[model samples]
Target: MTITQRKPLRPDDIIINEPGDQYSCDSCGCDLTHSVRIKCADPLCEPGDGVDICPPCFCAGREFRHHKRGHAYRVIEINSYPIFSEDWGADEELLLLKGIATQGFGNWKKIAEHIGTRSKEEVEKHYNEVYIDSQTWPIPKLDLQFSVDPAEFQARKRRRIQALNDTPPPPLKHGPVSLPGIHEIQGFFPGRLEFEHEIDNEAEDLVKDLEFGVCLEWDGDQIIEDEEDLDVRARAKWEEERRNPPPPAEKGRIPGKGPMINGINGYHPPSENGSVATRESLPPKSDDALANGTSSGDGDEEVEEVTQPPPIETKESLAFKLSLLEMYSQRVDKRLEGKEVMFDRGLLDYKKMQASDKKRSREDRDIVHRLRPFAKLQTAADYEVFAADVLYEALLRQRIQELQQYRRLGLATAADIDKYKSDLQKRTLTKANHRDYPTDKHPYRRQSSGPDPRRASLVSFGGDSEGRKSNEREATPRLPGSSTGQGPIVRKLPTPLNLANSPSLHLLSAAEQVLCAQLRILPKPYLVVKETLVREYARRGGKLRRREARELVKIDVNKTSRVWDFLVQQGFLNIASDVSSNHASSSQDASTASGSQVNGSPIKDPRPLSSQQNGPAPVPSTSSS
Candidate 1:
């Protein structure tokens, strides 16, 4: 549609909500709660008491309850199946479809596994993509069948499970074990061991009620695919676990100390006392040695040594208060030992480490301070916990940024991410290095990835005058005379013409550039019109319109998004016309032929572009650009 005529089909084209709806608890018609509200009924459609649209109505408006089309169909087609079917139109097999839709599109076995279909064989089984979406362009055959040897086996009925799913449970390591020196501790601990072992039917149960992070596997290596060093670091974890196991207790029990449910002397209590002797073991033993020098086997309790300070009477001074706080910390560490503790202790330890390392702890403290403003907690202590989570995350982020900087500067090793991650994890977890430090990928990691549409306006303004100036630069090169071959040589630019004119235009995110590529305006020359399109969109409807067509210069026809669509014809493209040529048809064709314009003029539509159809790639048919 031309910029002026570019109206949304309806006031709200894509209604985010459903008509009348029950998202969950269908039996009671209870709304299925979600972190985010779903489009219950379409926002566009209204259902009512003849006019009052309910959530179910809006949710089921059109899209939500529709029999979903699997997105992989673009690459999974009947490579060359003979036309013989019941009533079904021939399309790609689901297996082929799913494979090409995912990452590693050409791996046959993986594809088969993905689609729950048969995988590759000795022969390469190629498939074509068959899109059910009439609006969506056909995705070309992305080769999805790699022959196997030292390769992943092509999926068969027997192997329905993917690598990420269906892992065997570890052996139940929940029994007692005699340990040297540990036996003394065990007497007090008196509990079941927590050796790393799996429960029976754990995987089987997950197979039925699978939620996220259901399975863990040892895929030739531990699956810490988030970064490198996981394999080496993973071993360090088990070594520590093996070396320092808590003394094993009886079955269905944990030992030594913890919350009330377990330990006899914990905060949350069975009255702060563990199991009572079952009418058998509690009485004092009849042996003489038992009553002698051996201490009661109730775990080691530290005896604090007392040193009296120089006489302080009545009102204890600030020095005394400081001493009290110091005493409190020592007491906590003595009692709490190895486990989760309060933020105050953790922060103090963090500061101690910073001072020891000669690094300013204030940077880490500042991070916590920044997070303090966003804290959901009401109390100061609770906010400190919140601050710790923030501080740890911030520190990790800083490390990751440093790693990324190293990568950019070409100083990065394959180990940079993992090494830096290890450093951050050590800082966060403190002495506990066995378990993982969380690795999170930010949706908007870099500051520069986002766009300012006003910049697009600035771009529009800057380009016209600058484009004229560039035109002047090109036409009047470093020439002494108009016709002389040698005054000063006119050098060819390494980059394209339009790029030199506006370098800022190219400084967009890859995703943004991909959006621009969908507009098929690589090395864009028409900034004025594009900026106009953006401004027109904004003026018409701020976000909705702009989002409809955001970054235009690098739109890739193949990708899908809120921005540019391939379903509706772009004003630039000249598709092979489906309509037959007749006098009336020809006239309309001529108008549509120039793409809502007349005689290929800049009259309006930007049609008959250089290469709209048959774009640069028969590239791996990506679901996204």
Candidate 2:
């Protein structure tokens, strides 16, 4: 038989034969159940309905309309191997997921049918073992149980809608309505309230006299007019003036044919003619004119003539002028009332107020200046309240200072003052008794014979002679044993050695004191011996044998032996036993050696030992002396 070559399995060769596999390749338009499906993982590429590709198309890196080769892809294999349980393959897990998603979780029979191979009981058992009972489940399980009441929900919804409907709309935008008297002072017009004044009030003056067609015209020397004009000859002279335009008026001068009445350029003194009346020259007003509240002139006539004639007064203009005058008089009256109040309060005296302010402390002025900015923002009522609070705070601070003063004097109250006086008397008596009977601890305390020199010097002088006498008294010194008055005699005794005052003994602890007592050695001498041994031990690299210690303090062997034994027992000195063999030989040789002598005679050991143990005496120079 000829050998047949088997084809190698590609990644696409893993075919998922599950009936639940519904995904198809988007590119080749083939069912994905025969091969592994690849899906575009990019969130932006066909996000709602994801693009899926078969393994063959994916391996070939085919690009669809929305999916590109560069986009990340996720491999979806329905026939993947077992994950949580060996008996359940990935295909069965997928089917179980799909069935639960469609039919809900507790339908075991339907899930088994979807899984195909597993029975209902087996499927339920596997699900419980892998997901519910085991800790390996991927998603956390929540036992949240809640129910909604549709009636209550609907009631709440209706209430919310009703509340929204009942809410009022915002107010409409309009110009602010001023209080009755405010418009006169602020020049605000109530009727035309859009702005403070009419825009371009003088614009009408420019075009009021303009005519659409010329009423008169001139050709050569003859004048002409429109055919509709009945009085063409009457307007002929008027048309000549309009054509010439009077050679344009001079700068800074009004365009007029009349001569200036005064010497000043462009100035016309009020006319002396009775028809053109000046303000000062107007005839006295009649009762009817005054009752009508009209000036002394016809409504159309100019009351005063100067460079230009003023506009004829209308009812509105007269009313506005009268309101302005009334507002001015009211302001004047208010000012007068304020002045009277200031005079009554003596606030009108500027000089006195300034002097008083100058007398105030710098700190007070600084506080006022600092508060001025904040004061400006406050209303009258707010400012009054703030001022009251400030005064209260000042009163509290004053009370606190008084309390502190009383405390410093040891008399915070009337009862405290009585108690303080009694306590002071008792303290004085105790001090006198202590001075009379001195303690033994201070035997050599200086006795006061005369009055204290410092106190004598501090005494007030009655006269020059008395001051000189007090100075002479303070200059004199008293004998040591002599009494200032009939006081008891205090003898000066010799002071004893205070062990507490000893500097060396201060270094020893209670344990060291016990060891020192057992060795019959004073703590000072024991401390000296310890210091010497410690220095030698450290020099010997932290190892000291008994033989070396004995040789180091050989002056008085008995005392040195006691201190050494105490130090060794207290763990201060560590004697190495490794040199025991050499130490024994050295001891023998040391015993044969002569004793150390201060003079010619050899020193003798006070406590004799066996010849095998005896060596040179060990005595620290500090203790031996």
Task: Give the number of the best model, judged by lDDT.
Answer: 2
What's each prediction's TM-score? 0.14, 0.18
Q: Quote the lDDT for 411 in model 2.
A: 76
Cα RMSD of all models vs. native, in order, equals 42.1, 39.5
> What lDDT does candidate 1 reach at residue 60?
56
- In candidate 1, what residue range of length 10 has the lowest lDDT sum? 616-625
Per-residue CA lDDT of model 2 for 124-152, tens digit only, reads: 88788767885545642334233435456
Q: Which residue pairs of candidate 2 clash?
A: 553-618, 553-619, 554-617, 554-618, 555-619, 556-619, 557-618
| Clash totals, every prediction | 52, 7
| Deviation from truth (RMSD, Å), model 1 | 42.1
Q: What is the C-alpha local distance difference test score of candidate 1? A: 0.36
